[model samples]
Target: MDNQLLLSLTEKYGSPLYVYNADKIISQYNRITEAFSSVKNLKLNYAVKANSNISVLKLFNKLSSGIDTVSIQEVQLGLEAGFYPENIIYTPNGVSLQEIEQVANLGVQINIDNISILEQFGHHYPNIPVCVRINPHIMAGGNHKISVGHIDSKFGISIHQVPHIKRVVENTKMHINGIHMHTGSDILDIDVFLAATEILFNTAKEFPQIDFIDFGSGFKVPYKEGDISTNIEELGEKLSKRFNTFCKEFGKDLTLMFEPGKFLVSEAGYFLTHVNVVKQTTSTVFASVDSGFNHLIRPMLYDSYHHIHNISNPNGRERYYSVVGYICETDTFGSNRRISEIREGDVLCFNNAGAYCYTMASNYNSRYRPAEVLLYNGNDYLIRKQETFNDLIKNQVIIDLD
Candidate 1:
């Protein structure tokens, strides 16, 4: 939010940099906690794959949030960030039994999706507490690419497969401590989420030994001005009342969990890039930046909208220009976008870059990845250094063919 700080970061870290505000992350976490203040048993697990930077994980650690990891590497990163194994949950999908065992060895909670791996793992480790991911057969989410709870999705076991799951549990005598469901991402409708939660709770009733139910998070954040987002306050009130009633009926206190990623950090990040050229074409004006999809690919990949501002010309006259990147491919960030007048060498800031932007960056054109900075407590800390040419060739085995 501070233009001076952004300008200073551009000067220090060079162009095409990612800067995250720790204050914003903390504020968002606090907001979620405040909304669910009435809930007796609640756990907020921060999804690590959304942004795996160790610094970012450490910030969540400071907030006392649990870590939700999708890989063994993320589990290690969470541990390196000072989170205990009990505070981490490994919810990998479509992975090998060896990989699941590797993460389980670290003492974190294991959430199995497929029946094959679950059967194998449950048979071997019957004493270990595990969670089963169930598909509620409810269609939810903002986009098809993000929706994962539908019948066609490969994410979780179908609700109709409950009999099969129960058979496996009975055969292995495995301790099924939790039930989980992740409908999708970018969900703005609170009623749909609550509907999915009701399904999860109903499924939970079938498992008497269950200690928790994970209503996988897809709480949306505003991408642009006036954009709709999940109403956490209303959802909290409605969901809490239902959850309490369910707990009373079940005669036990069960933990309510959410694995939120974008909701916690989407608005906390800013991607800054310098304008390389301002070319005036016949029908359209082009504002080419020094970066490309290599640095931020959400726009080209998902048609995601990020508010672009000419930080160097915030007060300049407004104009319509096609903001593009330097990638060799036709990587258009925005077409016919109305922003403050852009000029060569001027810096532009992309809003809502916190969640999936940097983590998805790639060196497609062999371009160096930008540096990362974390702005916390009114100070800037360099989290990751800019990639160098040597990094590109670090793993390539060069052979001299004579």
Candidate 2:
């Protein structure tokens, strides 16, 4: 995005705001679609947990991409965003059978991860089609916290439990329609993903009634310039060939589904915060901002790196400064980072902030969350309004102790 545009947004909406480029999101989705165009039956399910904003979901819905949700509320949001029931997939991990049943009632595809809930749900609703989430035991992702398919991970059922899954299916007469596996996020290794896919394909053979194989997505996106991202074109070509060959061998044509969240929206987002103070400590200089972990917590939570830019002073000389926040804790966004010299009240933009940033935000320290804007079709729309003080205590009740 141009500096003038971001500057205008910062001036209009105030600082500590989230700006998403809808065009960039569409471009990313189109890139994936083009890469996998050779595949006859393919579905891209946008993982709603990444960014559950209804406007964002509506944009994907317009693109004909299916929605992948982790909760019944998200399923409702997807429906509210105009996605058809059959186009949404509810893939919750460690959730209750009641929640699964609630989502199933929404008419969306259900993906069960554990055996206990799977057996119970199947016993109760044998005719409903369901998908099984398997743990491939593959260690992949940018960090351990983001990785979910490791041997000890609680995200998916153990592959060794295939027999038990079969038992549940046979005893309950459940219709198992799909097999799914998600290695992790920020995965750069294509071979690792392919290996997981092979495992999923082999497991799918056990269920001849299956109509699809969901190779859950973790395609990495560049957080900074020169940073490596997943080679989707290469991955699409290779995986498509293998998938088609497998279908021919199995004598059936089935859909290849992927639930991509971060890969589609991360780079399209920019978090803009204004410098509140320039504090000089004993040994280092800190450029404190008006936002904290309550607004963007990727750095504090996962030690994630987000490329920082001084959009307010892009032409200024670069220097090293520790970017901190005003929260009551040691909330550091970046430490000793090189950026255009920052001045008090100058705005800083955090790159790759679209996916987990706002969705994971909280009202910690009683701070109001920032607003959101969408840059689409050469126009800026206020997708969300900034919270007020009343929003902080909207749900709290006071007792009269007089």
Candidate 3:
């Protein structure tokens, strides 16, 4: 987006804002589907936990995409966004059986990843079909924090425990309709995913009534220029052939599904924040912004990299500086990064802020959450307003301190 237009947006709405380009999102969604168009039955489920914005969710629905929900509230949000209950899949981690049962009552597809929960839910609801999340014990992304399919990870039932799962299903007479596996996020190797897919294919053989296999999405997007990303085209070509063969061998056509969150919207999002102060010490120059981790915590929480540029001075001489936030504790976005000359009140735009950014925002230190905007057809529309003091205390009980 034009720097002047972004500056105008900050002036018109407020600083510390999230701006998304709907066109970018559409293009990304089309790209993924086109890549996998060869598949007979392909299902793309937008991971609602990524951005959960009703507008974003509605946009996905308009794209004819299914929803991947991890909570009952997300299932409700999907329904509110105009998705049929049958089109939504619930894949929550470590939630209660009551919550699962509640969402199941709404008729959304349920995915069970734990052996104990599988037995319990199956025993209680024997007729309801469930998807099984398997842990292939494959290490992906190399980051322990993001890797979920390793042996020690708690995100899925272990492949070694397949006998246990089969025993539970047989004992409870539960119907298994789908087999699923998610290795981790920021996946760069298609071979690792294919290996995990092989595990899922093998597991699906145990459940003769299965209708689909969800290879949970972690397809990496380029965080910066020249950064290695997932090769979706090649993956589609290879996986499509394998999936078709599997379907043929299994004597039925099955749905191939993925739940992509970051891939569809990360590039579509831009986080805009105004420079509040320029602090210079003997050793460091800190470019402090009006927002903190309360607004975007990826840097502090995940050691993630978000490419920041000085939109205000695109042509200015680049200099290395430390970008920090106004939070009370240590909050550093990047250390010793070269950016264009920054000035007080200048707008710095952070790329790749679409997924897991706003949805993870908090009210720490009583800081109001930033506003959100959607840019469509070269026009800016304010989708969410900046929080006020009332929002900070809306749920608090101000008990009398006599």
Candidate 4:
């Protein structure tokens, strides 16, 4: 992205804004599809939790993409964006059985991860084809918070309980159309992930009526320069071959599905915030920005690193400064990071803000959420508006006591 263009966008829109490149999103989507081209059947269901902007969903719909929703609201958003119910799969965790039934009533595919819910849903809707989420008990990512397939994680049903699952299936006579597993995010080891897939394949054999196998996606994207990321091409090459062989052994063709969130959009986003003040402390210099963790919480929440650059003074001499936010509490984005000389009112751009940044935004400290802009072709479209004061109190009711 051009530095001048980004600065001009801030001048046009405002500081503390999120801008996404549509071309980058399309290319990333194409990368995954091309990687898995060898598969007889492949489905890339864009995970809606990453960035649920209606325009984003519609763009994926335009690309003929399905959706992996975690809530009924996301399913409704997909429908509003013109996606078919069959194209949406609900894979929620710890939700109510009524909520699952509600999603099923909407005709979207239901993926049950708990045995209790599985038996209950299977008993009621035995004819409604469902998918089962299994825990392979394999840790792929290094972070325990993001990795959900470990032995103690609360994400999926245990692989050891396959006989229990089979018993429930036999009793309810429910049709199992798919089997799914999500080993977690930032997956670097292709072999470890492949080993996990072997477990999934073994589980699939237990369900003879399976039509698809969902390898829930947490494919990591590079956060900074020289950062290592998941090798999608290599994994696709190896997994496609193994999946084809498995299909032959199972005596039926099955859809190879991936529900990717970060892999698809992390690189396409940029968060721009203007420097409010440059405080020179005794030991450290703080570059306080107009925004805080309320907008981008990954740094504080997951210790995630986002590459920060001074767009307003890109050629200026680099200086080590701790970039902090205006929040009352300690909201340091990066500590002692080398960035270009930041002047008051200068714009700072945060890279890899496309995935979980804006989606995780909150109105902490009564701060309004920033607007979102989509850069498609040569034009820029405002996808979301900055919240106003009225928005803050729209749902609040005040009682007069005097």
Candidate 5:
């Protein structure tokens, strides 16, 4: 989105707002599809944990994209957005068997990650088809805190435990329909990702009835100018050929699947916050915005970098300023960043705010969550309203303390 559009959006909807560009999301979806166009059967399951707005879900649905949900609520959201159950894959972690059963009853594809859950589900519902998520023990992602494929992560079942998985399948006579693995997010090395896929392919050989192999997506997106991100085209060209060969060796064509969250929507989002004050401290200049970690926590949580620019004065002389939030914590977005001169009331645009920003927001410090807008078809629509005091205390109970 342009500066004027963003400024206008903040003026219309208010600051500390989220605006998503539909065209950008669509183009990202098409980019991946075209990258792997050679595959006979391909599926892109948008990870719902990234951005679970019903409108965003509906946009993905309009694109004919499947959903990879991690919770019962997300699965329900997918259904509410008009997605077919079969097109929605529920891959929850550390949840109860009852929740899995609940999701399964909805006819959604169940992907079990741990051996205990796998055994429990298989024993109870042997006839149901399931997918196994294997931990290939591959390390990838921008931060160690965010990486899950390592041996220490509690995410997927260890690859060494494949024999145990087989035992569970055999004892229960359960059907394994798919094999899945996710190395992590912001994967920059195609070789590392391909190595992880080799492990998934090797594990897939154990399940003859599998119809799909999901190489869980962690394709990185550029976070800053000239930032090095995953080379989707090159990875696709090499992996597509390898996948086709693997299908031949398996003696059957299997559907290739990717569950991308950030890669598809990160660049499409913009977080516009109004500069509340310009504080000149002893040795640093702090441009504090009205919002804080309550609204965008990636910087504090994962040390994630979201490009910040002064959209209101793009051509002004540049200066070093530390962008901070009003939250009563060490909530800093950027430190010592050179941007154009920022004045009070000027709207600053945070780039790549699409994927995990809004979904991770909370009502911390009793602050209200911001509203969301969608720029679709040359029109802007407010997808979510700014939370009010009523929203904050809606579910809260106050005791009669007389």
Candidate 6:
């Protein structure tokens, strides 16, 4: 993105803003589709949990993409964005039976992970075709917090419990239409992901009525310059062949589905904040910005690295400074990072702020959320407006204390 354009956006929309490039998003969506082009049947369900903005969902919908929703609200968003119930898969964890029934009532595909709920749902809605989430017990993600398919994780039905799942299906005559597994996020090793595929295939064999296999996506994107990312082209070549062969052996043409969130939208986002003050402490220099964990929490929450640049002084002499936010507590984004010299009022842009950033934002310290802009075809469109004091107190019931 051009620094001048971001500067203009910050000036027009104010600091602590988020800007998304629509072209990048389209290209990313294309990248995934192109990678699996060899497969006879491919379904890329845009994981709505990553970025549930209506415009973003609509963009995916415009591309004829399906939606993978983790909550009932996401399903609603997908539907409001013009996606049919058949195009949306509701896969949630640790939810109640009522919630599953609620989603099932909507006629969308329901994916049950717990055996208890599976049995209950199977009995209640045996005719409703369902998907099953399996925990392969593989530690595949970069961080334990994001990883949910390990032996001790609580995201999917354990592979050992396949017998129990089979028994439930037999008891209720439930139709199993899909087998699914998501190891975690920020996955780098193709072999590690492929290992989970084998487990999914074995689990699929238990259910002769399955029609699709969903390998939940965790493809890593480049965070910094020259950073390593998942090689989709390579994975495509290998997995497409295996999936085609598997389908042939199973005597059914199955849909190869992937629910990718970060891979589709992470790189297209840029969070722009202006440096409020350049404090030179005795120990370390802090470039305090107008935002904090309230606006972007990945740095403090997951220790994730978001590259920061001094867009206002891009060609100035470089210096090492610790970037901090204005929250009362410690909210350090980066420590001892080298960037072009930053000055008061200089704009600092954080790269890779699309996925899991705004969705996790909160009103901590009673701070208003930043505004969002979408850049499409050389034009900027304001999607979300910055919050006001009215927004802060709208939900609170205040009593007169006089």
Please give each candidate's TM-score.
0.99, 0.99, 0.98, 0.99, 0.99, 0.99
lDDT of 2 by residue, 337-390 (tens): 999999998989999999999999999998999999999898899999999999
* Candidate 2 C-alpha error for residue 246, in Å: 0.5
Model 5 has a clash total of 0
True-vs-predicted CA distance for residue 210, candidate 4, Å: 0.6
Instruction: Report the C-alpha lDDT of model 5 over 1-402, residue by residue, as the tens digit.
Output: 689989999889997999999999999999999999999999999999999999999999999999999999999999999999999999999999999999999999999999999999999999999999999999998799878899999999999999999999989999999999998999999999999999999999999999999999989999998999998999889999999999999999999999999999999999999999999989999999999999999999999999999999999999999999999989999999999999998889999999999999999999999999999999999999999999988898999999
As for lDDT, the candidate ahead, 2 or 4, is 4
User: What tens digits encode model 1's per-residue C-alpha lDDT throughout 321-380?
Assistant: 999999999999999999999999999999999999889999999999999999988789
Q: Which candidate is the best by lDDT?
A: 5
Once fitted onto the true fold, the runs of candidate 4 whose alpha carbons sit more than 4 angstroms away are none
Q: What CA RMSD would you report for each candidate?
A: 0.8, 0.8, 1.0, 0.7, 0.7, 0.9
lDDT score for candidate 1 against the true structure: 0.92
> Which digits, one per residue and each the tens of the lDDT, describe model 6 over residues 1-402?
999999999999997999999899999989988989999999999999888889989889999999999999999999899999999999999999998888888989999899999998889888999999999999998878999899999899999999999899899998998999999999999999999999999889888888899999999999999998999999999999999999999999999999999999999999999899999989888999999999999999899999999999999999999999999999999999999999999999999988999999999999999999999878899989999999999999999999
Candidate 1, pairs of clashing residues = none
lDDT of 4: 0.95
For model 2 the local lDDT of residue 73 reads 92
> Clash pairs of candidate 2?
none
Candidate number that wins on TM-score, 3 or 5: 5
Q: What lDDT does the true structure give each of the candidates?
A: 0.92, 0.93, 0.92, 0.95, 0.96, 0.93
